[model samples]
Target: MLRDFSAQALFMGLLTAFVGFASSFAVVLHGLTGVGASEAQAASGVMALSISMGLCAIVLSAWTRLPVSIAWSTPGAALLASSGAVEGGFAAAVGGFLICAALIVVAGLWKPLGRMVAAIPATLANAMLAGVLIGLCFAPVKAVAFNPAFGLAILGAWAVVGAFNRLLAVPAALVAFALVLTFGIDIPDGAFSAIARDLLPRPEIVAPVFNLPGLVSIALPLFVVTMASQNIPGIAVLKVNQYEPNPGPLFAATGIFSFLSAPFGGHAVNLAAITAAMCAGEDAHADPRRRYWAAINAGVFYVVFGLLAGAVTAIVNLAPPILIQAVAGLALISAFAGSAMNAFKEAETREAAALTFLTTASGVSFGGISGAFWGLLAGGLVMGVGRFVAARKAKKV
Candidate 1:
């Protein structure tokens, strides 16, 4: 089989989807908590996000013959969670989301800004991106520490799958859940009730109302974080997969979709790196020309999921903890190591990167976003000052 349809390609695409599904749940949960949302509201939001990402991925993959996946802004959720109090709650988070979406749409329509983003040095962009993902992976590790058995089970499953079979490795999290269920892990009593509630018939509307204060506090930080963290890396994924994607249209579409769907529960949307990698690879389809089918399949799944938001959330709630933690930890390993690698690569810049890493790891917060934003700022400043000093010394000599 793989010889016929490109097993490697399929594996990559599936791996990407697995990561998106597993790691994103944390961010989604955070967003839901920030807003003090009802289970239904939270499900609706996730559903919108799933649909937006899935649809965007389908369009891009189909048109470009590349593996492309879309996802919600992870960094945006962090920003919302931190500054949620200031903005007065979930309503403000929604406002901030709308503003972020508008900015993306505007940027997409503006050629110069898009080109400038594209012109940034890949190394620096990647480094910045790595800084963003470091903490995301760490979050799951922290969760696991409090639940040793769950964590160990997840770890064991990951190790076994990774060592024994490459294909199994991507879906190991899903498998771990089955094991947990088999062993009769203690789950929340109302888990079944939640699941049943989600399955009930209902229309797809959330009655999103605008709040100026929330937009002001939430918008700028959310936009910057999304661009710096998710979109930049998403673009990088496309390049690595040999897809020279047009970032402008992609960003624009994501913005439009997010803006239109925000009331219905969608936030900022952007390209998906991990999932895109899989679709771009050869294994996703037998004919290179036909890989669009996978993307189309993803879109269909996303729309269905979005429409059934409640049920999906309930299902996620029921999923084994080990499955979530292990999958997130394993999938994010590459991102974590990559950030650390670049942070210390150059002797002259090492100090700056080190400062950035430490500050970010310290979990400092300022102006809504955390040290991930400040770490980049601090590193850039250090590098700038060092360069300026070096130039002056050379002139003096």
Candidate 2:
């Protein structure tokens, strides 16, 4: 392992962690707050998720000898942001999070259940994800309308960097955002003082309420989105990179960590898709076997970043809301494009996929369930009917 260590690998690992965290940390914060968490609680959630995913990445990579990078559930965060609030407030949301984590653990331990999750149609899943992302993707353009100077600077930086290296684009945009925050706008009074006071993140134990409505709405949708959007794509990334570790144990590890972190504000942790590709690919190390060290290095950095969550939250709070959303939207543009492509890639699945995308994007909610869940159900129904009709026509022929 020591022989495999190189400056290039180290830099790649650090860059992966930076890009992953900087790109989506705001989404996590927004999700937590949207679920009714206080500022401190949201900060705690960020710290917990960062630390949990980091430790999981480190342990899994060292043990499996694969670049098994872990990440906080970004789509799950998007689900939370779109779902609004539950009946019992943050405590209920916390309970739902616990349920979601437990379900993941179950999916890991039970092969049949895992297969069922795996059997979810990729088109429908991707369509649902596209729906979730479509709203946020427009934020950059909206921000340009709201505050041209701040928004355009970030967008321009992303566009320029993306032209050279797509992986670095979001992080570059984040840097531009920070520069604009520093020089373009006046710092909010007492923001620095708040940062000093909350320099260390403190875990706030939210007692779980277990409301039925919250469980059905938040817990179920969170589990489905996490598995479909994050884990499945993550495993595919590993396979494409010529690494196939036992996903069962990996799922269990992430689920266990997520379960442990739930009471302290973390939502969910799972196998990473985007950042995992960074660590597992040739960019991290020439030798695939040596790439595990890059993941280990990234894990170390994630923990360090988590420890500074309080300071990070303080700085984020000082930024304009539109600018934050705009940066986040820019970060997700690649993902949105990928998902949209996958959703409509097949001729047979096009109509179903379109329905899923439209329903999910419509933000329709019923019986306390989220639009994502409803959209998937609607799309799946259409797909099933289409298949049935095709089979009947074939029999007649």
Task: Please estimate how well model 2 matches the true structure, expressed as its whole-model Cα lDDT.
Answer: 0.88
Q: Could you give candidate 2's per-residue lDDT for residues 89-154 as a string of tens digits?
A: 999999999999999998988999899988989899889888988888888999899888888999
- lDDT values, one for every candidate: 0.62, 0.88
Error of 2 at 222 (Å): 1.9
Cα lDDT, model 1, residue 296:
54
TM-score of each: 0.78, 0.95
Q: Tens digit of lDDT per residue, candidate 1, span 88-158?
A: 45655666677779888877889876666556433344454455456556644664685766666666676
lDDT of 2 at 375: 90
Model 2: residues with Cα > 4 Å off, grouped in runs:
1-4
Model 2, position 283, has a per-residue lDDT of 89
